[model samples]
Target: MLTIGEFAQLTHLSVRTLRRYHDAGLLEPARVDQASGYRYYSAEQIPAAQVIHRLRELDVPLPDVQRILQTPDPGTRAGLVADHLQRLEDQLERTRAAVTSLQRLLRPEPATLDVELRAVPATTVAAVEATVELDDVLAWYSGAMAELDALVGTPGPPGGLYDNELFTTGRGRVLVHRPVTAPPRTGRVHPVTLPAVELAVTTHVGDHDTIDVTYGELGSWVVEHTLAVAGPVRETYLVGPRDDPDPTAWRTEIGWPVFRLAPG
Candidate 1:
């Protein structure tokens, strides 16, 4: 038998925690001195204390810990632990993404506010489009891109055309677009013919998660360059998501159609 203080030393759990566990009906002592109100534990309780300490290390919720402690079937107990581990992994991934996003936003890099004038050629491709709320855009785009790729049977550069009117109106129009060598002739994948036009473009080097700042900088550059905005802004995904081991390595090109300025 071990006194509360001795048990605390042996388990490395503080005396206060042992009392709390007893009060919570989690770990009861082997015997209690009724007159002195002293608690004692048998030598066998150490293993249970060790298990509790490990579960707590995982940051498992107390209610979950209680349920796990009471669960009898070995398979069921293992499943519960696996589920908690999966949740932790998912949370870790989100935290990593947030950290990377913050790092990019805080990095002091020279702003590439250069304005380049280029004549874009007319092209045709198979495309699928959706009018979606901003929050659901990524998932919707992924599904549409998958369908478009299946129909085209050829992988090519990914791009999207955004109509500004939708954003100001709380809705956005997006297309899962890819350039094709010929006219479209497949199911639900319609041929998209882009007319030749002048464009002002800037390349953004980072994850699309927070590329809005780059877009804002580029748009300002176009206005300052005296280019007259003509049509929807196009985002050409130069590096697809799966191509990079780290999402932060992806690159995107922001192109906005414009009319050339007359000589000053």
Candidate 2:
């Protein structure tokens, strides 16, 4: 047995922390003096103390730490820790995305936005579609894309058609598709006929995190050029995550159906 101070020295934890842990029922000492009220811990408790300390360092909640200590199964304890770690990773990625977007927005002289007018012919493709809320679009698209990939393989670079109402009014139809010789109809997947239209097209390079900024730039260009938007926005993923792991190499074409308001 070792005194509280001695155990703290061994574990590199403070005496006050040990007392608090005892009060919280997280790490009770092995024994306590009846008269003078001194806490004592055994060498066997050292490993448990070290584990609690490590968990605390990861910002694990006190209740979770207590649960981990109480649980005897190593796998269960590992799973609890893994779940928290994954949440932290997701939050970190969001933070990184926000920082990247802000950095671009804050640049003194941003790159010029270049656009083109093209007449794209109507075509049919295999697609998975949904009536999704604006806030839920990303999550919905992820699941939809996975389904399309499983059904169609990589027949061609994928594309998505997003309804204007989805952005303007918060809920609308969304379609994720791939061009295939023989479009399959399975589950939510089906063949879609995309009508040809005059598109004011611009390519956005890199992650979709900053794609909205590109959208704003394109909208500004359309207004400046005196054109009226006619239909849902179209996105053609020419070089995407499926083709290259490097986000910088990903190229997406943003197309807006528009007609000239003032003849040139």
Candidate 3:
């Protein structure tokens, strides 16, 4: 058995830290002096102490650390660590995307976006739609798209209609559909004819992380060109994550229904 001081030296952990771990029920001493209330740890406990230290160094939650140590399976412990690391990686990617977008937005002289006006005729397609909360948009989109693919085989590029209230009121109907000559009549799939409309269109080239910047630019163009928004915004995915892993190659076309305002 090693005294608290000797164990701290062997494990490279402070005596106070070891005591705190004991109080938290994380690590316990092998023996204790009843008369003096002193703590002592055996050499066998050194590895366990080091494991706790490593997990804490990575900022793992105390409860999670305890769960990892209590479970005897090495694979289970590794899997937990992997999941936490993946969450950290995803947050880092969002931070990088935000930085990239802000830098472009803050530029003194931003480049002009090519905005076009066109008339789109009514068309029918295999579709899945729902009333979605703002926070649930991405998850709902994925589920709808996957179901569409399973049923329709993605005959052509897929598109979505986003209601304006979804942005303004935080909850509204959203429709996602694939272009099919004959729309399916199975499951959540149905034929929905898009109404004919005039649109001011622009293409965003990259991941959806910063797609809002493109939307802002398109809206600004409409206000400047004396056009009034008339209907739901449309998004056509020309090349997306499902089709290409390289973000640089992805293309999404955004269209806002519009009508020319009366000249003042």
Per TM-score, the best of the predicted structures is 3
Error of 3 at 262 (Å): 1.3
Instruction: Give candidate 3's total backbone clashes.
Output: 0
Residue runs of model 2 more than 4 Å from their true location after superposition: 1-25, 29-47
Write down the TM-score for model 3: 0.88
The lDDT of each candidate is 0.81, 0.92, 0.93
Error at 172, model 1, angstroms: 1.9
Q: Where does the lowest 10-residue lDDT sum fall in candidate 2?
A: 255-264
The order of the candidates by TM-score, greatest first, is 3, 2, 1
On a 0 to 100 scale, what is the lDDT of residue 208 in model 2?
88
Count of residue pairs whose backbone atoms collide, per candidate: 0, 0, 0
State the local distance difference test value for candidate 1.
0.81
Q: Estimate each model's TM-score.
A: 0.67, 0.78, 0.88
lDDT of 1 by residue, 87-193 (tens): 99988877876786677568798356765678889878788877888778788888878877777764677888888865677577876688877647566578888
List runs of model 3 lying over 4 Å from the truth: 1-20, 32-38
| 168: Cα error in model 2, Å | 3.6
lDDT of 2 by residue, 142-178 (tens): 8988998999998888999999999989999999899
Cα lDDT of model 3 by residue, 60-90, tens digit: 8888888888888999989999987887788
20: Cα error in model 3, Å: 4.2
Clashing pairs in 3: none
